[model samples]
Target: MIKDHRPYVVKRAWLKFQKFYARHFLRPQLTRLGTGFTFMRPWHVELFGAPIRIGRYATVIATPDKKIRLSVWPAQAGKGHITLGDYCLICPGVRISSAEGITIADNCMIANGAYITDSDWHGIYDRLSFGQAEAVEIGKNVWIGDSAIVCKGVTIGENSIIGAGAIVVESVPANCVAAGNPARVVKRLDPEETFTTRAQFFADPAKLARDFMAWEQAVLQGNTYFGWLRHLLFPAKGD
Candidate 1:
């Protein structure tokens, strides 16, 4: 309870199983799933209706309570598509529903509970009909904060940051931070400052994997099979 109780071998096996499950089951659902992509709790990642593509080294994390969902429902067939570029991070409870097009460029980090949609789903007067559609283009290294809602017809420029709980209805220019309801530009990011992206973080895939494995092994060093089982059945205080 306090830490991972599973033995090293068991945890390693579980990781392998998750990867296998993602490869055979989840990969088929996506139009294009790039190499070295890590989908933690892949079963909780839901992809509905196609032409949804994700680029290389993408990290998607989902939990049972907060599943990541990507859905495309066009007014007509082939009218909507979702594309995520390289080294993107999609956190739990992120829902991206497209009725037109959504293009997220490289090294974007979409935090937990962020919702990105390209259509209103219902018209203002008719109510039943799908409203107008406009494409949303999120440029490179953009960060969408937790619980932010990006409404229809918004384009977020490169290196822009959307603050937590912001409701974006209009376009955000490059190198700025936008927040609040109707999400106004709060501050301009200094373009001269150096920016480190997720792409750079995952530059060496093999080294990164090795580093994670080493850390896991070290942390789970004293764990045993029976200890793990006991913790699960009757967890102790500070377990």
Candidate 2:
């Protein structure tokens, strides 16, 4: 019986090429690029239609649009303008519409499928609302979980976390965990540890970079392709 060569060849091709980009080029680009951090892959940055400004040490992992619902308008005036602060982590499948402006402060962790918009885009009563909208500001150290929708004109205070699938319609105070469809405060966080800004982290670049690299190694060690490839190319001395 002949071995299945197709699958093996395909696997080798992917492992040799695509995996390297995913591990090195993609990950590093996402990790190192700031206020405007982006993945080199178009799918990773498709909905990022606007000119995004990412601060220092920010991570943005734009995921594939499996459902093909991403529409990044080319209108530079107000179509998409996303601002992310320092030490921020934006996961995959996060859809941010920028008919208006969207501001995310320092130390923010925006999880998968998190959507934030500054405008209704289509107007409240009519479909043809061709105009810029209000800006949404997410304060420092805010952690927005998966599938959270932050609507227009909403201000989320510092050190707050929006729980998964929450739809925020109003302003939330500092040091609180907000959740639900029309997101509300679920719990309050400690003042000391709650609100941390990007200005705080990048104050020491050397220390911050060192710490972040170490953390990245620990978090993505076995998960990254490089780690696996290294193991495959050079087995442990004792193993």
Candidate 3:
């Protein structure tokens, strides 16, 4: 079988567009996009001066309606850091505030309305609130569900799932699925789930890409339109 460089080429081309836009259209216009992160419509909100390092193939989408509020700590005024590892998918409505530092590792999927904060943001006492808060570290291959809130000083381990509508108050270990208010570990994900199998590879990067291209071509050829027409004409298999 021949090695396909098309995917690599396509990805690099898109990365170029991302870099150009981040420097020219976004960074000067908005806040910071950092290095190697792709920001689509970052103008809607403000990400603090904290080094928002987005790894290769990581995406942060800030929509028109959703705005992310990032807090910059005075102690960290000169230096603050937020690092996201490779292939991390941050959906719309994700907000991260780092008064100290926050690290999210590779292949993590964060759904909509997920908020992560490393600091208390305000001092426990109003006077101390301005002081430096602790840092947060989220390990690799984590999935944070929609509308979940991860509070200050919490570290989520690798291969864990934070259920939708959960509020994380404490640290969670690897290979667990946590849910509910305050977010407790309900189930453990199998160790095998952490490693990608051959089927998964084909289903994700390979087949998914082919399917998308096919869908685009189908639309161009009116295949989808005619298929819908045929479906209306004959309610064949199942209603």
lDDT of each: 0.94, 0.65, 0.70
Query: What stretches of model 3 exceed 4 Å from their correct place?
Result: 1-20, 27-39, 68-74, 77-79, 194-214, 222-239
Task: Please give each candidate's TM-score.
Answer: 0.98, 0.63, 0.70
For 110-218, candidate 1 gives per-residue lDDT tens digits of 9999999999998899898998889899999999999999988999999999999999999999999999998999999999999999988888888989999999999
Q: What is the C-alpha RMSD of each candidate to the true structure, in Å?
A: 0.9, 8.4, 8.3
lDDT of 3 by residue, 45-120 (tens): 5655645666665566778887655544435465456777777777888888777778888788889889987766
* Model 3 accuracy (lDDT, Cα): 0.70
Candidate 3 C-alpha error for residue 203, in Å: 11
lDDT (Cα, tens digit) per residue for candidate 2, span 1-239: 12222233344454356445544544343322343332323335543343655676655555456221233343345445676677887677777776666778878888887778777677556667644467789988788998889988899998888999999989999889988978889898888663446557567777876786576455444344554555566656542
Residue-pair clashes per candidate: 1, 6, 2
Task: Please say which candidate is ahead in lDDT: 1 or 3.
Answer: 1
Query: What's the residue-level lDDT of 216 in candidate 3?
Result: 48
**Shift of residue 2 alpha carbon in model 1, Å:** 1.3
